[model samples]
Target chain A: MDIFNGIASGFEVVFQPNNLLYCLIGVVIGMLIGVLPGLGTVATISVLLPITFGLPPETAIIMIAGIFYGAQYGGTITSVLLRLPGEASAVVTTFDGYQMARRGRAGAALGIAAIGSFIGGTLAIVGLSLLAPVVAAFALDFGPPEYAVLALAGILLVSSFGSGSAWKCIVSATIGLLMASVGRDLFTGVDRFTLDSPQLADGIDFAALVMGLFGLGEVLYDLERRIKGNSAPTPKVKNAWITGTDWVQSRMAIARGTLIGFILGVLPGGGATLSSMVSYAAEKRAAKDPSRFGKGAIEGVAGPESANNAAATSSFIPLLTLGIPANATMAIIYGALLLQGIAPGPQLISEHPDVFWGVIDSMWIGNILLLIMSIPLVRLFIKILQVRASIMAPITVMIILIGAYSVRNSIFDLWIVIAFGLLGFLMKKFGFEPGPLVLAFVLGNLLETSFRQSLQLLDGSLFGFFARPISGTLLVLMIAVPFLVMAVRLFLRKRVAQTDLQKEYENA
Target chain B: MGVPTRRSQDTATQSEEVGVVEADVDDEAVTPAGAWSHLVAGGVPLAFGVVMMLGSINLGLGSPTSPQPGLWPFALSVLLIALSIGLLVGRGRFGPCESFGSGTLTVIAGVGSIAAFTILLPLIGFEIPAIVLAAFWLKILGQESWRVVAMVPILCTAAFHLLFVEGLGVAIPHLFSF
Candidate 1:
């Protein structure tokens, strides 16, 4: 009854005219950007973050949440229609989705994906609505030490399991921590890395850093390679309907995918791409005739589509409940929340119930809008894919530069954008992921402050962290995971080598 | 004749699409030529960490019981140095280095124009610098036609002026100071 009441009040917030309008705008923009190849959700969100600076926090988050899930649905369109995947999560869809499209069932494939996404997304929201409050309540008693450990574990998990090598990720995160220390020390009033510049006194602007790293940085990297135009003929969708058998086959797959997606989505480094991959593989393994997969099986489309959407919806759990982002997009949203002066944590639900619940309720409305609009808007989105990156790149760059300047009307921030843009480009060139860096930057101050507070509270005993049950377990896991991974790798290598030697002896 | 040639060009671009896809996937990692590149890449961060650690010592690293301003940063710098060393000795490769391809010049031009715009904005205001940046990107980097190169920057600049300045009342520096 409390959950229902909470959700009902959430719906009341979403029904506000401006909130509804921004939801529509967010989805439309999400779909348009998702239709384009090189422009990703991160870049799009970073570019649009400036616009949200002028709006209410709830409205801003509602629109952003819409963009997040809407892009998940939009990504399916390109994967099914073209062999090209619009987003990383859509990659698995290309195997079966394209085949179904080639067999003249593009409409059915799209229809199934939309339905599955709606089901899965709605289910995940139910899970989030029920689970988020409990988790936040549990975390309410977490002291500075627990927060410090959790933040450390979070950074380590993201960096280790994220896109790049663990060392590279750790180094990137360390740099972020150092960068966050650039301003005046809150307690001591000593400027750490300001280089005697007055502008650096307030520390680096979060907006400027994000705009440069994600927006302009992406544009610069994209310029290195030419954008290839899609030549695949758009599949005709004569029937925008699924057959009875299609529903029968996919019903279980959808259920399985939603569960798989939600669990994976809750983990720090686990995301839509990993969940979708797992779901598709699980569907194939579960099928009576696995050979039919990649040859126009409806279950393939249903499973991954459901899984990715579910993952996207549930990824908000850690962010909304724990004050930690699970991935890059969540990190950007985390920054957006911080920009709005809202510290997202356990207290957020009790403190800013409107933003927390409004965002959750908006996801349901957003999915409904996507389900209704995506099929009709497919043709329009395909046209968006035809726009050359040469034209789009400069425009995006211009927007990023202008947006950075608009943050504080300071030229210094513009220089910061350019500087970080160059740094981000180089980082990408060196195979370093910017995701960990951004995540660490957002959580850097929190991590440092909590670490200091814990030390102060514990009277400078480094071993005091282990005295607490929760922080100790987390700290142990943080230390153990990397060594565990290394040990496993070493064991596997030795086994393989021994086997190779035995094979040589047998041949002799 | 024009139609046939244009169609052929389109097909050529289409044929290159698979390569672009492969390149995008492979763009995540590139095998370095040798340990030298890794050394250089890893060394920069190592040197930065060492310098910062020295600076932190000067800034004062207090006892854990009574921590100073430099304590956290000093610890982080040491960790950074350790990680950099790990990277240097580790067998992993690095880099997705920018090829000296056709777009290299375009990228340089793009960066140059942005830097120029940053310097010029405070001096002359936004309109002229914005127009110049747009013109450079469109004409030089994008290689749009002369007509487009001339028209788009003016229209885009004027539209930006109206939107950011007149509409939103954002305090962007302007020539007229309105």
Candidate 2:
């Protein structure tokens, strides 16, 4: 009955006028950002982080959560109409979605994608609502040793599963941990890396670092591309209604997608992009005519769209329950929660029950808003894209600078943002995925404090960590995950290659 | 004393074990920059690690039981150095990063403008610098026509003023009041 009570309270919180308004605003911004190619969810969230500070934690999270899932469906519009994937997860949508558009079934494709997204998102919310409390309850028994090990394992998983080399990702993570170590040491009261600045005592502002990396950094990197200007013409959207056949075909695809997406989204690094890709493949295999897979197959669009949306919703489970960010974007949300003075771990359900239930329940509301708005606003979103890059460049830069200053009303944060901006740009240029770095940085202090406390219990024996049942099991699993993943991936690649060869032989 | 010594040794080995699990992917992001960019990338972290370590040691590495403030950071600094070394040894084989090219000047100008804005903000309040920065981005960076360049800065600055200063009553200093 605690679950029911929590749900009831969540509805009470979300239905408030202030929260409802913010939710509407968030979904709109999310749709626009999703439609735009140059900017992404991470950059958008970073820009808005400062603005969220003034709002209540529950309201802030509700808005942010709305933006996240709204962006998932926004990408589908561009994919079907313009053959451009607005988000990484939407890449698979462009394949059959664009083909459907070319075949003059654009309306059918769009309508089905919207419907599929709704089902997938709604189902994922149900899963999150059911699963989050259970996970939180299970994690309540965890001590410092378990926390320290869990934090390390989380970062390790993100790095190993990231797009870049494991070495580079880990190295990036190390830098984040190192940065987290700056300022005075709490235990001994000794200054570590303050560089003699009094303001450094409290450590670096999370807002400044993130705004620099994701916001200004993306702006700087995308500067050249903006100069060239966008060349794609907006396609007209019409008759956004699907046929019975289309719905029949898409229903099963959406169901399978929801399942695939929910499972992957719970993992440390398997987020929307990976889940969407997996769902697309699964749909293709299940199809009666595999040849129709890429050439305007409605299931192709339905499955991946559903999967991406579902994954987007379910990825919140880790952060809300375990206080471990599942992906890069979640890392920023985690930072936002911390800045709100709301600690996100097992105690969150009891300590900040309003915020917890409110965020989850808000997703249900946000998804409905996305479905209602996305189809009608297709032209408006396309028009938003037509606005010259010149207009956006100054505005984005201005917001970033002003936002940085808002952190503590300090001029120093402006400089800090610029420095991290340059560093972030360089890292991106060098193919370093900033996700692991951000995740590691967010978790670094938590890991450190827990580790130091755990050491007292271990009796000064470093080996005692692995000798304990919980920490030891976690560490062993941490070691095993990368190897197991690599082996499975290798096996799959070989099997696919053989399958391709056999298909070629049969065709010949 | 012996316990502290043994703990440090154990931590080092454990770090190395983590390091050895360097499972690589076929990364598509990096273009073939010369070893120079790779060297710079590797060397920055290495230098950063060394500097942090020196400071950490100065902070004092207490026993695991006692756990000084620097102990965790100090351990991390060592790990940082090892990882950077591994990166340097990579010789651009894993993912050779992109070198700075034609876009360097644009970035430099962007950074330079941001720096100028930061300096001018507290000195002259936010209006003049805001106008100047907006104009530079829209005109110089954006390469828009004179009409757009003339109109956007003042209007945009006014909107920000309305939102932040008037609506929210943020503590930022501004030259004008309504």
Candidate 3:
């Protein structure tokens, strides 16, 4: 009943003309960019961030939030129609959706994606509304040790999950931390790694690093493939419309995905990419026709689409309640909040209910708007997908260059983008996963700073990490979960191999 | 098309051709070989991390009231070196086979475009360099007709200038500013 009142208040804020307009605009832009390969939320958000400086912080936050989730919905379009996923989470969608498309069921695939995203996003918001208050209350009792443990657990899980190779993930995360170290030491007048460059004193901007790694690097990878003739025109779409049976098949898939996504989204370091993967695996396991899964099952499209949207929505809880950013995008949102001079903590809800409630209300509104807008535009989006690499390749690269230059009006940033672009290309060539590197880069500074701060609280000892029960439990979970997964995988593989050998021996 | 390898049946045939074109110097380490190249990549970061740890020991570690300078970096670097060693021992058992195809044109165009942009940025300013870079890149990538060349630059520069400069308020260094 109390939560219902909060929801009512949230609706009142979201219903305002300005907030509603911004939400609509955000979703439209999110869809457009998401439809375009090599253009993601990070680039769009970063480019548009400076403009939000003039608007009401609440409105700006609402609009940006709209773009974030809207993009998730939009990303499914290309994945289903063209087998090209605009975002990482949508990668799983391409498996089944593209197969469906080849089977001339593009319409059904698109419909399932849209409907699933709406269901998932809405349910996750409900989870946020109900669960955030409880979680915030629980987090209120946390001290430095608990915070330390949470940060470490976040880094360990994020880096490990981000990088397919555990060692690579660790190294990339470490590199992120080192890059964060390039400023004037807060306590001493001594500079650590500035190398006498005055600009280095302030340290590297996370935006610049993100742009370098994701934005520029991605375009360069595209360029190399195109030039090598490996990126010829992909299969084009004739239609992207859904049929009646799609809704019936997708209802349970959407519901299940939303639930799975909500739980994962609530956990620190659990996000859209991971949720989508798990949802895909779950759907496959539960499907009566498991063999049809990778061959264009409608449930596959519905499940992951729902999961990603739900995960995207739930990621906001930690930021609003505890001032903890579980990922880079949320961290940037935190930065934007800081610029508004709004300190996110226990007092935030009571003190700034409008900002909090307005955002919550707008997320629901944004999801509706995106679903309505994207459904009709599915064919149009597919048409844009037909835009050849020749046209997109140059334009994407130029945008990268200009984005790098515009950040500080410095040419040096352009060089940084170029350097990172080449590095990204080489990494792609060698099968080095770039997602972990980017995620680690984003979380690198926060992890190191918090870890060190916790140590200092305990007079430089690891015991502090284990002193807090929550921290200790989280650490134990972090160490245990990966090993358990590994062991399970090994056991399953061994069993299968043994069975195969036995069959062969008997036949011989 | 040459005869697709047996390995091509399970894997995407596209990347396989690129792989065959490359000299397989360490073929044994290539397939299911592990993370040798990953281990090699870890070396630079590990060394960087070791330096930071040593540097932090020389500096004061900040406490609760006052944050220390080297504290975060030092600890992170130590983590880096540890991870690097872990990667070497755990992942360095194998390497990826390099591609041997002639991607020289792509490499040149891709790398050249950036170099040109950097050199041109301070001289001709953002608009011209961006347009030129866009045109050149598109051309090199095989969209060389005048329509593509003309339309792409005009649209790209106009849209970029509008979104970034006018809309976002990111100041563009004008041609004469340099």
Candidate 4:
């Protein structure tokens, strides 16, 4: 379909009352989670997953996507008000956002951030609409070999770029693959790891695992530490509108941030956090007086805010077109899609046009909703932040436990949730990332299927993967990434060591 | 997407620490007890890998031409073992292992409550277990006020009952099945 028709139809999907309502709910929940520090989008989405079980696939995705991007907006409220970032992406915003608040220009800073985020997110949607179909069409001809290589590269890139050590990420992913191997083997119809248990026969439940690992696990971890309530006085918003000078100063920064965020967001492992930091640095560098950055500069708030929202939106490109999640949040969304029986990939646009377009279109509406509601809702969201974590944590755990049981109405699933929850807590304590494990679990079957199929098609020759143009390129890139990272690290280390040597000589 | 070089691991740890503070819980800070902790952490995956390898051997490792189910798992097991060894070898670089301290007791209580809920829910229904779990957490772990500890559980349980059972019609085992 053409871009114009796709967008028009997308609007039609978004206009449905059900989709619109869910979109609103999603954003509201997203904002709430974003404003609250302990509960992240990942856990929130996991806990809420069962609620979407009865909805149509398109509505389910639209709502979940809303939560993902709407969070980018919600995070700014805390950063500007309390100098405490409610979300990881909002960390940089606290620099100038809090400064502006202290200077009694809090309203102006927030207003500019909201405006910039709207523009950035909307622009990214347009870019997604224009680019997604082309990429999907290009990948339409990917054979088993290409898919195998792509999946391998995808897993590797996510692990290497993820929050933990590459080896740990790999181990987590390997464990996920092993978990996916449980139940009856697809190819052989033989039980690989079920251990004669009836529940194990069907394989481990995804919803149960997620709720346990992310939801309950989070609760346990939070139990280990005390959460201090916010003592910062709420900044009064006397004037929420930015002056004409503020607009002129921030317009270019917003545009640059949008562009930077969009480009970076499409890369595997690149998301809101990276984009925000880079945009802030970029704005600082481009400014005539860089010294104004940490001192209530509107550009500082505008740039990173725009960049994060834009990055959040554009990160969908990989998940939608390539079937590879760009970051941890996208990985959860990918699982949601799979639960809805939709496998996201190059064929998704062709196979599920309504779902594909509806999600993208709803993003435009979600942004509009955020822009309209953020100002009015800021006070309400701030009130949510004041709620004590002690009260919230157990309630969240109960919800997760019950939610886990709700899926398939099995008590065995509850046990699974508890088990994985404990495992997740220990993993966190020991510094292992659950994101890669989840991502790997979601992609495990696909990876294995592609690998075996590629081998079969290539007459059992491993070199067959390298014979194809696309697959070969992907394999080469995968092989090169680790070496490249190692080289960069080595160079950086040498530079630091040399600098220290120079300091020592000077001191002597 | 914004910055090319910012590591996500750093962001995750920062957010987690932030969450801890926001929750108003005082943590007993202690450094990881060096090699022993590292050994424990790394040993887990190594143990699992060893068990998996042993299991796969019984399943028969078929050739590449027409692979068996065990072949793929065996490959991953080998990878897991290798990574675990690497982790042990470079344990110092991974950072200080955090001692659970006083929080360990809280974790134990929390987990115990969940286990109690699971065992009791099927037999006695969800209401009592739910209330008890909430109250335990509030009073004991959270150290909430007696008034709050008394009131919140009943209110939360009522709300959840309405939402999950009455409104959504989820098939939770309640005291009154109707």
Of the two candidates 1 and 2, the one with more favorable TM-score, higher being better, is 2
Selected candidate, larger TM-score, 1 vs 3:
1
If scored against the real structure, what TM-score would every candidate get? 0.90, 0.91, 0.82, 0.92
Q: i-RMS values of the candidates, in order?
A: 6.8, 16.6, 9.4, 8.4
* Residue-level error in angstroms, candidate 3, position A387: 1.6
- Native interface contact recovery, model 3: 0.43
Model 4 misplaced regions, further than 4 Å: A479-508, B1-33
For A311-390, candidate 4 gives per-residue lDDT tens digits of: 99999998999898877778888888888889999989878889999999999899999998776656656656555567
Candidate 4 TM-score to native: 0.92
CAPRI tier of model 1: acceptable
How far residue A309's Cα lies from its native spot in candidate 2, in Å, is 1.3
Residue A408 lDDT in candidate 1: 89
lDDT of each: 0.79, 0.80, 0.67, 0.80
Residues A281-361, model 1: lDDT tens digits: 788879999888879899999998999999999999999999989888898899999999999999998899899999999
Task: Evaluate every candidate with DockQ and list the scores.
Answer: 0.35, 0.24, 0.26, 0.35
The per-residue C-alpha lDDT of model 1 at residue B36 equals: 57
For model 1, name the residue pairs that clash. none
> Which residue runs of candidate 2 sit more than 4 Å off their true CA positions?
A487-508, B1-31
